[model samples]
Target: MRGSLTTCVLFCLLSLGLSYPMMKGKPNDTSSKPFPLEDPTHNLTALADRCTDEGFDAMTLDDQGLIHLFRDGYSWSGFRGAAQFINETWNLTVSVDAAFRNHNKNQPQTHQRMYLLQGSDVWGFYEGHLLAGYPRPISQEFPGVPDNVDAAVECHAGECQTDSVIFFKGDTVYIYSPMDVPVVKQRHWAALGPCTAAFRWLERYYCFKGINFTRFDPVSGEVLSTRPLDTRDYFVSCPGRGHGHVARQNATLMSIKNRCSGRPFKAFSSDELGRTYVFRGGWYFRADSSKDGWHAWPLSHSWRNLQGEVDAAFSWENKMYFIQDSQVTIYRSNPAYTPVQGYPKPLQEELGVTEVDAAFICQSSDVLHIIKGNKLRSVDLKQSPRLPGQERPIAHTQVDSAMCNANGIYLFHGPSFYLYKDVEEMVTAAEPPEPGNIAATFLQCTE
Candidate 1:
C-alpha cells in the first residue's frame, strides 16, 4: 500500500543513516531490510530544520498541515504568559494574558488582559479605567492608531499599562476597564480563566482542566459543553448522562462509557476486531471481555509488566500494541487472559523510540503512523510478522506533530503543517464520527 510523503521522507532519512541512498541512482534496495534489533546506540543526523527557539508549551496538528503551537512570552507586569498562533502555516494562534497595562493617566487600571490573533491581525481586549476614574473599554481600534498597536502606560512613578483585566468569550470578546465613575451594571460575561489544554473535533473546541471539560466554538466563542472528568470520563460520558458507548459506534456525536470499574479506556483503533478493550491503569486487562464488562477471560495468568508507564496503546488484527518507555510492545491476544507465549517481542531495537513522551496513532491506507515526541513514523503491520527481527527508523523531525482524521494524517511543523489527503482516508475508513448534535457551525457567544 502507498504511504504518506512524510513517512517516505522519514524512511529515506533512516535509510541514509544506514548508508543506503534512497534517490533514483541507488543500486541496492536495502530499505526493505528489517531494522537492526540489537544496536542500542544509533547515529541520527542532527535535525537540519530550524525550529522556534522560544520552544512550545503545547502543540497540535490542524486539519491543514500547519502546526498550532502555544508559546509563553514576556509581558509588561513581569508576568510571562502564552501568545497563541505565534507561528502558523495552517493553524491559528491566540494569546492569553492577565497582565496587560494601559497608560492613560485619567484612567484607573483594571486587571484583565487578553489578546486574540487570527492570521496577522490582533484584537487587544482589556477591562479597566480609561480617563479620570471613568471606566471605559480600553482598545486599540480607535482611529489614527497604528494597525499594529503596542502601548505602555505609567502609574505611581512606575511605567506600566493601566488596563489589565480582560477575558475572551468566543467571538464576543469582553474588556473591563475601571474608572472613577462607577456604572452599576452587572456584566453577564463569565470571568476569564486560564487557557490550558485544548482539542478540536469538527467545529467544536474542547478545553480541559484535570476532569473539568469545556467546549466552545472557535469562531463565535460560545460555550457549547462542559464535563467535569479526566481523559477517561471525557470520552465515556461525552454526550450526557444516559448516552452510552453503543450508540456512539456510528454516530457523529458518539459517547463511550466506563461501565466497568477500575478499567479505563485507552486509544481506539479501527481494525477487524471491532472490539473495544480497556486498560486497567496498566498493560494488562481481561481479553475479549466486551460482553462481561470486566474479567471475562484473563489473557495471561500473570500481567505482563512493560517496565515503564504506558504512553500509547492500540489494537489491530486481534493484537494489542503499546508504547512504554520508548519501546513498542505487542501482545498476540488481549493481555488479560492470553498466555505468556502469546505476547510478541519488540518489533525493532534501533527505531530510536526513546523520548517518546506521548503519542497519537493513526493509519494512512494500510500503513500505521505512530506520532510521538514531535516526529512521525510509519509502521507496516502487514510486514511486521514477516521480519520478526528487522528494524528501521521511519522518520524523525524536531519541528512537527501529527493528528489523524478520516481523510488523512495532519502534520504540524514550525508555523504550519498541511494535510495530506491520501493518509486521511485510511485512518477514518473504519472509525465513525464522534456522536452528538454537534452544531454544524459554532455560533459566536455575544452574551
Candidate 2:
C-alpha cells in the first residue's frame, strides 16, 4: 500500500511539471536556514500546496546514473522543497537508492550510492571516506547546512528520523551526522570483518556480512563493540566479507617517518587538493605521504581521453598538465582524479616543438615551462604558449629524471642531484661536456 501511494504521489509530481511548463523563476536560493529539525515535517503539507500545474521538468540523470530532480524549473534547491511535498502528502521518509556496476570484478560487491534529502540539503558518499566534493556540493560551503557531514555510502539515499543520515556503499552501511561534514558513527568499522551489506532501522546503523551483522552505537561510534547483531533482527543476506570471505584490504596508514616506494620519477606535480601526482610507466600514481606505498590512479583512458599513458603531469592554479613526448594536454578536475572535458591540445601549435621530455609550472611566474633535453620554452597559455625570452638551455648530465619546485629545478641521477640555479643561462651558455667528462662537472648535493 505504501509503495502504491509513493508511486501515485511521484506520478502526480511528475505530471504537474511535465504537463504545464512552470513560469520561469529565479534559481532557488540555497543559503536559507534549513527546516527546523524538531518539527521538520510539521508543515510539509504547505509545500505540497505550492506544487501546482505551474512547474518545470528539472529532472534529469547524470552520467553516474543518479536521477536528479531539481525543484521548480531548474537546479536542486534541496530535499526540503521536494521532501516537504512528499512527506506532507504522505508523511513518509524521503530517501533514494540506486545500484551501480562494480567496475572491478575483484571488488564484486553490489556497489551502490545513497542520496538523502532532509530539508534542502543532499549528502553523498563513496569508498570509505566522505566524497568531500563531488558531482555537487553537499557541505556547509554550499549553504543551507548547519552541521558537518563527512561521509555516506552507496544507495539512492535512505530516510533518517534521527539526527544522522544513513547511506550504503560496497559491503557496509554507514551512519553520518549532517553538518559541514558528516562524521561516520562507526569510525572503527575497519576493525570488523569485511562487510557485505548494511542498513538502518529507527536510529541505529547496522552492517552485515553473509549472516553476521554488527550494530554500531550512534552516540559512541562503536561497531559491534558491545554485542553481535543477528539476522533474526532483520531478513537480509550479506555479500560475505568480500568475495572469498577474506578480510577487507585497506590502505595502510603511514606516519610522517614512512616514505612512499616506486621512486625514480620521470615527471611530478601537485594538484589543488594537495595531492602530489607522479607519472611513471604510462601510469600516474600518488604516494600519500600520510600513507605507505603508492596508490595507482585512474586508468589512462580517464586521464585525458588519451590513447596512450600520460608521460608527465603537474597541477597549477586549478588545471593539470598531461605531457606525452612533445604533445601537451591540459586537464582540470573538480572532484580530484576525475578529469574535465576538452583537453589533449597539441603543444606544437603554440610552442612549435614536437618533442618535450618534461614540464613543470614555475611557481615564481605561475607559468608553464616545457623542457626538451637541455632546451627550455616558457609558454603563456592565456594567448597560446609564448616564449617571451630567448629559449634557455638546462645543465644536466641527462634530461630524463627531472623535477622542479619553488626553490629550483633538480635533475637527479639516483641520489646525485644536478641542480640548475639559472636554467636559462645553463641552457644557452653551457656547452655539451665530453661524453665521459660529464661525471666531473655534475654537482652532487652533499652535507
Candidate 3:
C-alpha cells in the first residue's frame, strides 16, 4: 500500500488531541521493509538548487528512474506532497489534491495556495511563479477539516466554475468551493474504504481506496461505481504520488510519530501581496511559493540594530513591521520582497506606542492601531507626535489580540468575539468604568 488513509486520519485526530480510540488489527505475518527511492528530476537537489524559492509545482521520479513533469496541472498526495502547473500558453485549469496546508491565504485577486506538511514546507504557484509558504495549522483554520486529510480540488466541477475541493475524514466526505478558500462549505458520509487518492476524469470523480476504487456523482455525492483499481489506471491519475509511495503487498504504514518532525520555523505570517515570511529563532526566510527549494537566509543583518528572534509581526500599507522585545523595526518591501534600507525605529519613540503584542491598520483611516492588554491606540501618519485622543481602552477582560478588515475592530478574549465600531470612539472614549462601575449594564448584558 502506498498510503493508508486509515493511518492519515488517525494522525489528524491525534494531532488535534482528539479522544477517538483506535481499533487494533492483528499484525500480518507478511511484512516488508521500506523500499529504496530514486530522484529522477533530482527534485531533492533541484529543490535545494532553486534556493530562495521552495516551490515544487509538479514533478516526480518513479521506481524505474523515469522523470515526470506537470503534464496535467496540479498533482497531490495526502500528507506527502502536491503541485500546480499554471502559466502555460493555453492558460489551462486542472484539479489536484493539495492536502498539507500549514498556512493559507488569498490575495486581492484570489490567487491562493496551501503549504504542505513534510519535506518541502510550502508548495504552490503564485503569478506563474511557484511560491512556497509557511506551515499553518489547517485543522484550526478550516474548522471541520484536518491538516492531514487528502483532497481532490478542482477549479470547475459540473456547472460551477469556481474551484471546488473535496475532503475525507473516516467515511465522511466534505466538499468546498473556491478550493483555495479556508472555509468548509459542505460535507457528507460515504460507505467506502478510507480514501487515499481522488481524481476527476471524463466529468466524473474517481476516489481510490487501497485495492478498490469508487466513482462518485460529482453533484449528488452518490457513489456511482465501486470496483477494483487497476494498476495502469491508478498510475495514470497520480504519478507524483505513485513515485513517492510505491504500492507493495505487505508494507505497513508509517507511524504517527514520524509526521511531527523537522519543522522549518516556529511561527509564520503573510503580507498584502500573498507572500508568507517565516521566522525561527533569530533567522527569517521568505517561503517564496513562486520558486522551489529551501536555501535559508540569515535575518540579524537585514533589519539593522534589531536582533534576537521576532516576538510577532504583521503587514500594513505594504510596509513590513519587525518586532523584537519592546522595540519595533519597519522595513520597506523591494522587488525581491526582502527588507530594503532605512529601519530600526523604536516602537515608543517612532510611534508613541510601547509594549505592543499585536498590530493592524484601519482601512478607512491612515492610522496604524497598536494594542497591548485591553488598551487600544492608533498612530496617525499625518499626525506626528502621538496625542491623547489617539489612545483609548477597549473594555474587555484581557485583550489577547485584535484585527481590522473593511469592517472596524474585532477584539478576541479567549475564544469569545466582541466587535467595536467607530475607531474614533475606541481611541477617544473614556475608559469604561470597571468593578461596581456599571453593574446594571454588565449584569443585564450577561443575562
Candidate 4:
C-alpha cells in the first residue's frame, strides 16, 4: 500500500529555512542522534493522544511530491508528531523533529533536499530518516534569519521575477532570496492576521491560521477574496467536516491497452504548471517531475464540455486550446481551468485550419503549428484573423499528436514519439531519431 544535505559556509549568502540539512555538527550531542533507519511503528493513537486540534505546527512537501504535516512533540521521546498528506487525508505515519521545513522544487535536482528546523538547530532529512551528524546551528547556516520563526514557506509568485523563502514572525515577514540580502517587511493583510504556518501546493500559496487557512498572494501580500477554509476540513480527515476526502476518489488502475498502447488524442505541456497533459479516448494522463507518477482522470473531471476525445491541444498566451471535430475550445490555465466565454468556435474560424491531426506552439514563438496528414501549416497567433501560412511537408507521413516545450517538439505517432530539437528540425529532418515507445517514455510504463 503506502510508503513514504550539503555545506553551510558556501551557502551563507543563500536563502536559509531550506528543508535540506545544512552542516554536520558534533556527533556526540543528543540532538544529533541518528534518525531511525526504518519508519517508526505507525501508531495513529499516538497522534490522537497529542491531538488538541490546534492544527499543524508546520507543513512542507518533500522532493518526492509527498505533503508532510508536522505536529509538535517532545524530541527526546522520539515521538515527534508527523503525518503524510495522502488523498486529502492525514496518515499518522512519519515522525521528525522539525518546527518547520521548506522544500523548493525550483532548485537543481541535486540541491532539491529537505531540512528540519528545531529551535536554533537545523537537521537534514532524507527519505524517512534524518541524516547523521546534523543538528547544525542556525546562526552558522542561515546568518541573519531569526530562529524559531512563526512559519516558513518557499513560494514563487506569478508576477514576481524571483522565488523566495517567506519567514513569518509575529506581524513581520522576512523575504529571503539566494541572489540578494534578506528583506524585512510588515504584514499587510489584516483580515488573515499573522500566519501560524504557510505552504506551497500546485503553485498556490496557503497561509494557515490555527485550523483555518486563506489563499494569499506572496508577492502582493493580498489575501484572496474567498473566505478562510478550515485546514482540518481541507488538509486532514475529520468527522462532520465534509470538506476533505469526500470529493476525492481513489486512483483507478488502467488496463494494459489503455496505459500507453494506442495513438494519443493530444499532448501538450503547460509551462505555468510544469505538467504535461496526454489525452486519449475519454481519459487524460498527467505527468510531471513528481514521484506521484502518472494517473488517468476522466476528461470531464478537469475540462468541461467538448468531451469524448480531443483532436489536438496546445497552450498559448496563458490559455489552453482544445480542438475536436471542426470546433475549438479555449480555457484559462488556472486551477479551475475555466472555459473562456463564447468558445467552441469553428476550427477554421479560429486557427484558419479545417481539421488538425496534431498541433503545438513552442515557448519562444507565437506561431501555432498545425498538422494534418503530412502537411504542417504555421499560423502567426500575434496577427489578426490568424491566417495560416504556407503549408510545409513534415518528415512523418502522419502525426497522432504534437507537443512543444523548451527542449523542442515531440511528434507522437501511433504508440511511438519522435523528439525534434526544434520546429526547423521537425519539418526538415529527413530521418528523425528512432521513435521511442510512448508508454515507456511519457507514461513511465515498461514491460
Candidate 5:
C-alpha cells in the first residue's frame, strides 16, 4: 500500500509540472472580469444622472470642448459649421470645389484657379500667377519667349515690307515684331503672337488638358504642382465619383520615403495614376510578389498590376489585415511574394469569428479592431484562441439598425466629414451599457 501511494504521488507531481507551463502563459482571467472603476469622489449616481441630464446621449468630447449632438444621423457634429470644434482646437471652414474635372480616367485636367481665405487676405494662385485680388497692369510680359526672331518680313501688298519682322519657328511659331510699331494700337500687342506662345507653354505646364493634379496651399493659396496622372503612382479616391465604384480597393493618400534617408512624404508624380501609389508613414509595410510576399519596400514604391485586382492595401503592425467581401482576412505581411500565413487556417475555428463585416487598424495605436457583426472586438495577437460563442453576440452590432452597409464600418475620418469608420470609432469610444452599449464602451475605452 505504501508503494502504491508513492506511485500515485509521483503521477500527481508529473501532471502538475506539465500543467504549470500552460498556466504560466495564460492571461490573467481576472483581468477579463467586469470592473466598474469610476471616480470615487464623484457621486456615481449623480454622474449617471448627469449623463442623462447633460444630454449625455447627445454629448461627445474629444480632448476639446463639448461635442454637439445631431439628430439627423450619426455624423461628426459641427463638421462644416463655423463654431464646431474639430480634432480639438482650430475652427475650420473647409470648402471643396472641383479644382478640375477629368472627362476620361486616362486624362485629368486642372482648373488652375484656387481661392483660399484663412484669416484676412483672399489669396489667389491662378496658374502660377499668384495675386491678392485681380492685380493691374493685370498683364505681365510672358516669361518664356525667344529673345530674337530668325526672320522678320512685313507682308504688305503681298510683298516684303521695310518693317523688320522676326519669325523663328521651332515646334510652334515665335514671332518678334518691332515694339515701336503698333498694329492694334497697342505696344505689347506687337509681341502678341509671342505672348500667345508663352501662354501655350504655361498652359501645358500649369493646366494640361490631360489628367493633372493641382494642389493648393490652404494657407498660402499657392498652386503646388500640375502634372500628368502617373500610372505608376497612386491617388486618393473619396466616397464620391469613381471612388465608390472600386468597391474593395479605395486609394486614400500615397506617400513615399527617400531610400537613403528613409524620411517618408508625398512622392511627386506626373503619370496617369498620379501619386496614388504612395503609402503613408508608420504602421504600414509593402510586400512584393517576387519576394515570396515577405519583404519591406520604401513606402513610396510603385508597381503596375503587381497584384492584378489588388491596387493597394492598408495594414497595421506588419499584418495583412483588410476587409474583403465583408470578411476580415488577417494574413502575414509577406514582402517577398510568399504565401500569406495565419489565414484560411484553424484561426477561423479558434477565434469563433465566422464573419468580419469591417475592420480597421487604429492609426494612433496600431490596434486591430474588427466588427464581427453587431459587435466590435480586438483580436489578441498573443491569444491563439478566439472568444467563445457566447462572447460573439456581445462583440457585434445588430445588422438591421446599422447606419451604413456591412462595409460601413470602414468609413474615412476627415476633419469635416466622419465616414463610417469614424462613426464606428466614435460609437465604440462612447461607453454605455451592454449589448447595444458595446460601441459606446469602445468609445469610452478609446477616450
Candidate 6:
C-alpha cells in the first residue's frame, strides 16, 4: 500500500510537470523520507525562491498574539507590527485531522489556548501542547457544519461585538456562537474566492489564498485597497525580502541629507525599549554609528500615520508622545508603535501647552519639562489636574531639543549640545557645561 501511495504521488507530480525530490531509498522501502526542513536560522538561504512560491497551510495567532504561519513540515512566526516576516522557521509537528478537507484556519480560544481542528476532531492547543479531554468530534462541537471547511476566524471587539467564530466553506459561511445556533449565509463578497486561511489582525480582516492575501471589511466584505499582497512581504519578516527593504534602499540611494551640522528638531531615548531617535525635517536617524553615523530615512516610513516633522517628543510609561503644532499623538512603545486610539488630541487639552520647542521626562520621574524658547515649565503628569507648574527662565537663550537619561539632561542648540549633570543643576545652575558639537558627541562623526 505504501509503495502504491509513493508511485501515485510521483505520478501526480509528473502529471503536473513538477519534481518530487524524496530521499534515496529502495523502491519498496517504507523508510524513504521527504526533503529535510530547512534550518532558516543557520542556512542563511531564502525559504522560497520567491515570497509567493508557496502558500501557508494554516495561519493563526499564538498565545502572545504573534502570527504563526504553517506550511509543508515547517512554521514561521512574526509580529503584525510591520509588513515583513522575521527570518526564522521551525519544524512543524502538529497534525490536522483529515475529517475536514482543506481546513486551514486556526483561532484563539482564550489568552492561553487556541482551537485547532485536526481531521474531524477539534483540539484545544495551549502553550505549545494540546490540552486534555480534547480531540472532540467536530460534528459535536460545531453541530450542523459540514466537512471541508475552507477557513475559520474568531471575530472580536472591532470586527464583531459578540464572541463569534466564522467558518468558511466555498460560497457558504457559518457564523457560530457558543450561546446561539450557527448563522448560515451565502458568501457576499464578490472580489475574493474561498480563502485557504483567514484571521483578524490590527483590527482588519485578512483572507489568505495561496501566498496572496486580501484585506477586506469584515462587515460588508468590501475589498480594501491593496488587495492580493504577498503574505511573505506583509506577514513574514523575511530579511532583505520585502518592499520595506526596497523603500530603505531607495531612501539610501537618494541623498539622505545629513543634519549633523544643524540642531536636531527632536531627540528622545526610550529607556524601556533601548532606542534613541533623532529627527530633522522628514528624516530621522536611529543613532546607530556602526551601521552609519547618519542615515536619515523619512519619519513616516518608520512611524506609520505620523507625517512631516514633530515639534517635540518624549517617552513616558512605555508610551511615546509626539507633540505637533497643537496636537499630540500617543503610541505604545513597541516595534510597531501602534497609535493609541482617541489620539492626535488637542495638545492644549492633554498637556495644557499649545506649542513646545523641546520636551523630555527624566528616567523614573513624572515631571515633564516643557521647553519654549529659553523658558521652562514643568507639568506633573501623575496628577489628574495636570496644570502647568511655575515657569522659569533657563540658562540657554533658546534651545532646539532636549532629552534626559540617568546621567543628566542634554539640551540642543544650533549644532551643539549642553549637558547638565542632573535636572537640579538644569534649574539652579548659573552656567551649564561648555557646549559640544552634536556630530562629534553623539554621532561619532569627526570634523
So what's the TM-score on candidate 4? 0.66
Every model's TM-score: 0.25, 0.39, 0.35, 0.66, 0.24, 0.48
Q: By lDDT, who's the top model here? A: 4
Candidate 2 Cα outliers beyond 4 Å, as residue runs: 1-264, 290-293, 301-304, 307-309, 337-342, 385-388, 406-408, 413-447
Tens-digit lDDT track of model 2 for 271-388:
6545555454553444322111112322342353443545556666677767776666766655433455555567676456566666666554566666666667766655444543
Q: List the residue pairs that clash in candidate 4.
A: 19-114, 19-115, 20-114, 20-115
Stretches of model 3 off by over 4 angstroms after superposition:
1-76, 79-271, 274-314, 340-342, 386-390, 413-417, 421-447
Q: How many steric clashes between backbone atoms does each model show?
A: 70, 33, 17, 4, 59, 11
Q: The CA-based lDDT of model 6 is what? A: 0.56
Following a full C-alpha superposition, what root-mean-square deviation does model 1 have from the true structure? 24.1
lDDT agreement of model 2 with the native: 0.37
Ranking by TM-score: 4, 6, 2, 3, 1, 5
Model 6, TM vs. native:
0.48
**Who wins the TM-score comparison?**
4
Order the candidates by lDDT, highest first: 4, 6, 3, 2, 1, 5
lDDT digits (tens) for residues 162-240 of candidate 6: 4566776664566655444545444545566576777654344667677666665665667764535555444443444
Whole-model lDDT per candidate: 0.29, 0.37, 0.40, 0.57, 0.23, 0.56
Report how far residue 55 has shifted in candidate 5, in Å.
Answer: 60
Which tens-of-lDDT digit does each residue in 1-447 have in candidate 1? 000000000011111121111110011111211122222222223221112222222222221212223333211110011122232311223432111222333543322222333222433443311223221232322212122211111121111123222233222233233444321111232422333334332112344333344544433335654323332222211122211234235332111111222122333233233333333233232222211111211112222444333545555555556655545666655312232354434534523344443234443234556555433456555663432222323233332334344544444333233444544442334432232210111101111
Better of 3 and 4 by TM-score: 4
Alpha-carbon error at 3 in model 3, in Å? 22
Candidate 3, 45-119: lDDT as tens digits: 322211112222222222121212232243322212223243232133432223322111233333334322222
